[model samples]
Structures are given as structure tokens and as C-alpha cells.
Target: MIRKVVILSMLLLILILFMLTIEDININTSARDYLFENGFRETGSNNLVTAIYLDYRLYDSIYEAGILLVTVSGIIFMSKKDDDVL
Candidate 1:
């Protein structure tokens, strides 16, 4: 009974939080125009896609690379046989 009550409360909290977050989102329609006009000047990269990838989303790219490295390391560690451990 307590567990069900706790789960229901958690679900209600999550739903409330989701609703609150969703209410504040505003969509921008002129993002492409702004980017095209200023992307080269801001980033100094000739290629728009490269400028966006490297300058605009540098942290995202780094985090993705870090995740890939960790996943690969985990796979390697898990694949090792018991005899491989010193």
C-alpha cells in the first residue's frame, strides 16, 4: 500500500513538472536567418555545417565523444576473461 502510494505521488510530481516545463517553451521561427547571417562572423568557419557543429555545439560533441569512449571501455572491460586479470 505504501509503495503504491509513493509511486503514484512520484508520477503525479513528474506529470506536474512536465506540464510546468512545457508551458514555458517558445518556438523561434527566424533561427535559420539569424544563423546564416551571423554564423560565419561569429565562428569564422567557411562551412556553415562545420561552424554549427564545432562552435555552436562544441560541448554537446565533446560529451557525445566522452560517452562513446566510456561505452567502448566498458565493452572492453566486460569482454575480458577471468584469466586476463592479473
Candidate 2:
């Protein structure tokens, strides 16, 4: 009985959060406009997409790459047979 209640409560909480996020979708437009107007000047890149990705979100990209490398390494390690080890 308690487990069902907890699951229902969690579902309701998630629903509320999703509704709140949907209401604020327009807020991102201002940032998009600012980037479109000043991205080149601030980042000194001719390509807008490149400027945004390489300058504004450089740390995010680097962390994502690191995460991918670690995930791939872990998968490779886990897939290896024990007999392969010396």
C-alpha cells in the first residue's frame, strides 16, 4: 500500500515539474536573440553554431567528451574475458 502511494506521489511531482518547464519555453528566445546578435563579436568565430558550441559551451562539450571516453573504456573493460588477462 505504501509503495503504491510513493510511486503515485513521485509521478504527480514529476508531472508538476514537467508542466512548469513547458510554461517557460519562451524564456529561451531572449538568449537565442542575444547570441545571434553578438555571438560572432564575443567569440570571434565566423560560424554562429561553431561560436556557440566551441565558446559558449566549451566546458560542456569537453565534459561530454570525457564522459564518453570513460563510458567506452568501462564498456570495453567489462566486455573483456577473464581468460584474456595475464
Candidate 3:
């Protein structure tokens, strides 16, 4: 009974908090402004996220692809059958 009451109160509190919170999505944050100001000049990319991942951290992207390739290869090797050994 006490647990149920506690859970109910906590959920009510969360609901009230969310209801009173701001709902603005077009908030021009500082990070967005900074990225907009420097993304093109620093990385020569029109898309900010693409500029970050492809231009600024090309090695990281390459390494992640390599890891994915290795993982797929391992999965394929493990999933293959030895039917010829019969």
C-alpha cells in the first residue's frame, strides 16, 4: 500500500513538473550559434553534423566503419556451416 502511494505521488510530481516546464523547441542555444558560426569555416561542410563526423573526425568515422566491418565478418564466419567436412 505504501509503495503504491509513493509511486503514485512520484508520478504526480513528475506530471506536474513536466506540465510547468517550458515547451520551446526553437531556443537558439549557444552551441548551435557557435557551430553555425564556425562549422563552415573550420570544416568546409554545409551540414554541421556531417562536418563534425566526416571532416573534423574522419579517423573516428573510418575506425567505426572498420569495426563494423570486422563485426559483420565475424558474424558471417560464425554463422557459416561446415557441410563440406561430411
Candidate 4:
């Protein structure tokens, strides 16, 4: 009974906290313009989005690609395993 009461109180508290939070979503036009005008000069890429991913954020892109490769290899390995254990 005490555990239930505690959980219910926590849930109520969390809900009240969530209600009190304010989120602002605004677009920055200048950032987009700057990237569009100077992306090639800064990163040597014709595409702004590609420049951001491949040049400005190469490490993150490489890590994400590695993760994808590992996930694909893991799935293949699991799927091709023999049914000896079962």
C-alpha cells in the first residue's frame, strides 16, 4: 500500500512538473542563409547539408556509418547462425 502511494505521488509530481515546463520552437533564418552562401567556401562542398555532414561534422558521420555497418553485420551474423543450441 505504501509503495503504491509513493508511486502515485511520484507520477502526480512528474505530471505537474511537465505541465509547468515551457518549450520554444523558433527558426533562425540567418543561420540558414549564412550556410547557403558560404558553405562551399568554408567546406568546399557544393551542397550545404552535405558540407555540414561530410566536412564540418565528419567524425559524427563516420561514427554513425560505423554503427550502421556494425548493426548490419550483427544482424547478418545472428541470422546465419546454425540452430545447434536449440
Q: For each candidate, what TM-score against the reference?
A: 0.59, 0.58, 0.55, 0.55
Give the root-mean-square deviation of each candidate in angstroms.
Answer: 5.9, 5.2, 6.0, 6.8
Model 2 lDDT per residue over 12-74, tens place:
999999999999887658888998899988999989888977998999889989999999888
For model 4, state the Cα shift of residue 53 in Å. Answer: 0.9
Clash count of each predicted structure: 0, 0, 0, 0
Better of 1 and 2 by TM-score: 1
Query: For residues 1-86, could you state the per-residue lDDT of candidate 3 as single tens digits?
Result: 99999999999999888776756345669977888899999988888889988987799999999999999888887887877321
Predictions in order: lDDT? 0.90, 0.89, 0.85, 0.84
For residues 1-86, what per-residue lDDT tens digits would candidate 1 score against the true structure?
99999999999999999999989988675988888899989999989988987999898889999999999888988999988842
Best by lDDT: 1
Better of 2 and 4 by TM-score: 2
Residue 35, candidate 1: Cα error in Å is: 0.8
